[model samples]
Target: MKFTSLLKAATTVAFASVLIACGNSSSSSSSVTEVEFFSQKPEMQATLQEIVDDYNKSQDEVKVKLTSVPDAGTVLKTRIANGEAPDVINIYPQNADFKGWAADGQFVDLTDESDILGNLNEGAAEAYAVDSKIYNVPLTTNVSGIYYNKDAFDKLGIEVPKSLAEFQDIVKKIKDDGQTPFAEALGDPWTVNGFAQLAWIQSASSPQAANDYLRFSDKGAIKSDEVSKNVAAYLDLLAGNGQSNSDGALYADTVAVFSEGKALMMANGSWALTVIKQQKPDFEVGFFPMPGLTADAPTMTVGAADMAVSISAESKNVDASKDFVKYLSSTEAMQKYYDVDGSPTSVKGIDTEGKFEELADVADLAFTDQQAIWLHSEWTSEEIFWDVNVSYIKNKDLTAYTDALNTFFDTMK
Candidate 1:
């Protein structure tokens, strides 16, 4: 919500200023060139500002102006098409549909820049690469897990559930005892998608399974039985009488429910920790991996770089932009960013204890030799996947859902 609000505010400011500046502009080349950074999260602007301040202090050649745009992917596309695009942009590779953009040569390839590419996490580097060409440099990585109210679990004598069946049983018991089992924000697209993503991962055990379901590839088989069954089970749990929020509460409301201690458990990515801690410092909170669907199935969590900074293909100050990005990726810069934002650093071996202790255990599990995958929306057309998921959840029509998914894949061509 902070991010959304920030984007709207930024757009209003950009629009008003653009109108006024157009009247006074005589020679645009003489003034400080602004490197507009379109970003979704308002909080990220603070981290970027830190880097910009440092960059500006050290050099007089270029001035980097960052603008927070809501729905950055859409904004970037529209601006680029209108020939008013920025020189540098910050976006989630998944949300920005970086792969498709790269295929169309809309983004500048940074594959040859080993200095920037080498500093990123392996998974992040791979995600930022399309057709073996790197287009973006990751700023931070976020992972998803179950956040529980420590006091509630302790009082209920409930250990963190380790398997899906156990988790559902715990939820049912909690409900039977007149307490909400889980807090979900269906209104917030991310919150609804968060649960859908968890279910997708649980149903699709292997990496290949994820690729098949998410990418809609014809090569991989769809475990429709597993996926459909899990979807029904998860929805049944959410739609049960014990949910704290109203029947169709959005994601923000769901988060508020958990932060206010109305629910025992809420599924969210690491970013929620900041808001939770800020709002409920006295509340004891802990996290665990989303329980595995099968005992032997290795646990997999949703993860991706929080933001990737890329040089715009139309950038006039490419060298300065690259320098700025390089500095942003340095160990010192990343440490500061992580400290300020509670974000997990992309640089390997950076100590996280002081800033992100809540995530220490989960982060350890994530970095283990076990494999992980990005969220489904990250690899597919977000509009199609998100719409199909919401429809399936609300309607529970398996045939229609699967057919729509197959049609989505056909459209990808």
Candidate 2:
């Protein structure tokens, strides 16, 4: 079954109108206006509710009715089809094709609110824009890189790798020293494929090569050879490091391995820092850019707006939603979001302080050096890109990789 269909089947309807006491103040003369919010991540739901509670306590004009939808993509789609969707939605670019949805007139054009939009990263704003109009407020941004167990590396006497060849050598050394070199969550196609695609980009002759391959244009196809080579290199790394489980590693399993210190390195986004720190508070963890296969690539990494808030075009309380979005983009809310969520900032000029310092440093490097490429799922079909990568990882064959790319591009044409 298609992933979308599976998600639809798994989704459950939840309706609630209970009011919580936070910091919101209610006035006797103001009428209560309820707006629903749908979110997939439990942590995101909690953070958002806290924000809503604070907002509600500040005023009586608007009350947010938040709902936790585990299968947000499916539930949102169904709601849209039935014309019963929430007033405001948190849409992951991976799940919802922002361009297609905007073209179909599904979102409210947020161009009029340039004051808030101007605070976001230009690339992010463009990604969520259609026909020169922005439709969503970027909440947070995240970048992917190598997260290594410093203690394990020290114990094994293996140095941090600077190049793809050196990376392979380090993994081999770790394995020889009786440690797992890498951890891969193969059961979740997205997680497994992330490694392959990221490796491909990092191995490219130039960052433009990776960009072209993602767009799948004619020029992209020719430049994509480096991508294929990178995939092959990744497969070799997994096979040699004893990281590819025959049963296939699930996302939870991969996290467990890393948390338990069984693996030395894992490639993931900076958002994972909180969980890792919580699980093993004293575990010495260090991060580095994924090493390049060729020196010319210069350590390319992937990043994107972690989440986006879009007002429903069909919202009865458009002004209320707009107000909420503006508040969400404000310095105060963005600061609170960074404090609680630990994600890199999308809005400029916020004080990062001591929160996720490693991630913040890496993010600054990527942004300033122009070494960051937004993750493919941010602008492409997740089903095609993710599935192709997972298949290549499992099979260790290049045929599927080539075929998948050809098929994806053909569909686009």
Candidate 3:
């Protein structure tokens, strides 16, 4: 798989080298317009370089040099402050810093980039829009959920559970059969945050409750019995049946452990499929939206645009940067990205029929249902929620979590 293969290739290249080679400033003889493309996702370094190579080879008018750095938000902010911002940047909308950046007009207003943005998924594009003006065009989008091993389920005579009790039964069965029920990498806050987001969504009593979690401004916002119970249930699942070393496991460990069949399930997104396929090519996998808290309340999905391409408002070469961003939105670029990234594209009319063969019914349900929730919208500062979620996972202390959330909410308001 491109994800695994390219990542391996990326390791051989020094990070400092990649950062130094930001653009084609050294090539004085080259007449092409050189656009510096910056991205925060280190995993996509080699894959993005491939995308840029393909684009440069396809045309001569402009050249894109890819610079993938760490700590995306901090790096981007520093670059902007230093007046050395990349010409085109890949933005992750889920980052809390993006809200400030959008408001500050960091990126060029893309509302008028009709040719590039016209065929995009309207819901996703609208998510990136501020004041009816969009500054970024989504590159790829994915849904977060429980990714499970289908072969293990079939071997154990387990079917997809419709209710939370049934799901817990399957988890217990997996554990009884000498298998790890879940691949939990607690070292990464985002993984636990994903689970926390699902729990909050499943605990919601109404659609309004699910959508507007941030509106609960009271001190008891996170102290409700229902939410505390759900949080406890989630912690019990991880602590009781997760992989042996899951307490200290990292993101790479989760991918390796889950892919190698050491675990039966992973709470993750559609992107894990490719890497898992790469590790165990014949392994069968399936996905389900996080099961609801009880039978009466079934699970619903929350999705947001994971990646988007935007041009720096301060770019010296606006037209060149626009060209690169436009290329990123084209069908060819999207197809290649979807193939490697293993996520659904937001571009309309792009055929993704067998693209998600690993996920059969789960794919259908995600696309057909329109109840898309931006999970991050539940909190004013996502970093605070991440910390609270990690603490909850570590201790299952609902009272402390609630107090922290209330304090954070008070600051936000």
Candidate 4:
């Protein structure tokens, strides 16, 4: 519970010394099963370890050790490459790496894990479903949107817009008021990448609308369509409306600018709110889903599976890993994670009423199955797609979008 326990997961110990459980449900009466859980979520490391500690103390049958390191993606790839897959892992199901590993049977097939999947709020698990089958245990869900400064909006007498046109008008109104419209940090490709994805999601239709359009529509949709063109135009509008010299601003700089009340809005995921909160700005910050084509459609939140854990299919200790994963599904464990992280719980019964009020509006979209899993997660190479969007944002060229759709066909479809 102290600051020191946060380092519990940052160990370099190999799995060679641990007692691996037999694959079957039953283990030797005298021996305790040792299970490895490699995690990439640094923020939740200690929380996970605390849960592990509780689980370990509750029983002597299996011990779950959390393994985390700096540069976890590379470490995980190397471990799996060397046939040292952790028995359990925390992975984002929407990422390309998760897709590849799931396809290759790196994780256990949880299609029949009704005891686990059934506990989650509807679509929380399905949003990240790999080929309609569940491979990861969805715990907490995160949503993306525009975080607006309440004081700034109040000063300008601005109301939250419910349509794309209205949203554009707000941008113009902010600009006309001689204030910055957005804190877009183009210097950080990921920020631009987030804005691009959110634009496409809100512009196309709504949650599933964006999901299907990107995955099943014509590959040329980005090349020739009102929707695609409108999205591109909006991206152009956003690129031009950012804070002063925003193209060179770092992600931290945007947080600072937005926190200082110099910028009206910031396009980012739910995680950014944490950083903004730390700065203790005078005004209240609120979040709303990116505006869609119409008022009713304005609440589409773009996000994905957050803090999802899965078991390795190739593990020698399947039973032990299952035991650990089952423990994670308990209402107590999920609630512990939800309480500390302030993230919306994917589990069915944890009440999030009045918590994280800044996230209230978008949280509705998140739990009600309204979040569109990040489209890049479905791509063959999401980074390359992100690079294309970044290219468009910087050069303000439409052809970069053509390259994006080409990536959709070449790597995604």
* Top candidate when judged by lDDT against the true structure: 4
TM-score, predicted candidate 3 vs. hidden true structure: 0.81
**Root-mean-square deviation of candidate 2:** 12.4
For candidate 2, the TM-score is 0.80
Report per-prediction Cα RMSD to one decimal. 11.8, 12.4, 12.6, 10.4
Q: Which segments of candidate 4 are over 4 A away from where they belong?
A: 1-29, 206-221, 367-369, 399-413
Candidates 3 and 4 compared: the better one by lDDT is 4
- lDDT, each prediction: 0.69, 0.69, 0.73, 0.78
Candidate 4 on 319-397: residue-level lDDT in tens?
8888888889788888888877877678877767777889888877775646677776755555555667666766777
Per-candidate TM-score against the hidden true structure = 0.80, 0.80, 0.81, 0.86
The most accurate candidate by TM-score is 4
Pairwise lDDT winner, candidates 1 and 3: 3
Could you tell me which residue pairs clash in candidate 4?
none
TM-score of 4: 0.86
Tell me model 3's lDDT, rounded to 2 decimals. Answer: 0.73
Estimate the lDDT of model 1. Answer: 0.69
Among all windows of 10 consecutive residues in model 2, the one with the lowest summed lDDT is 14-23
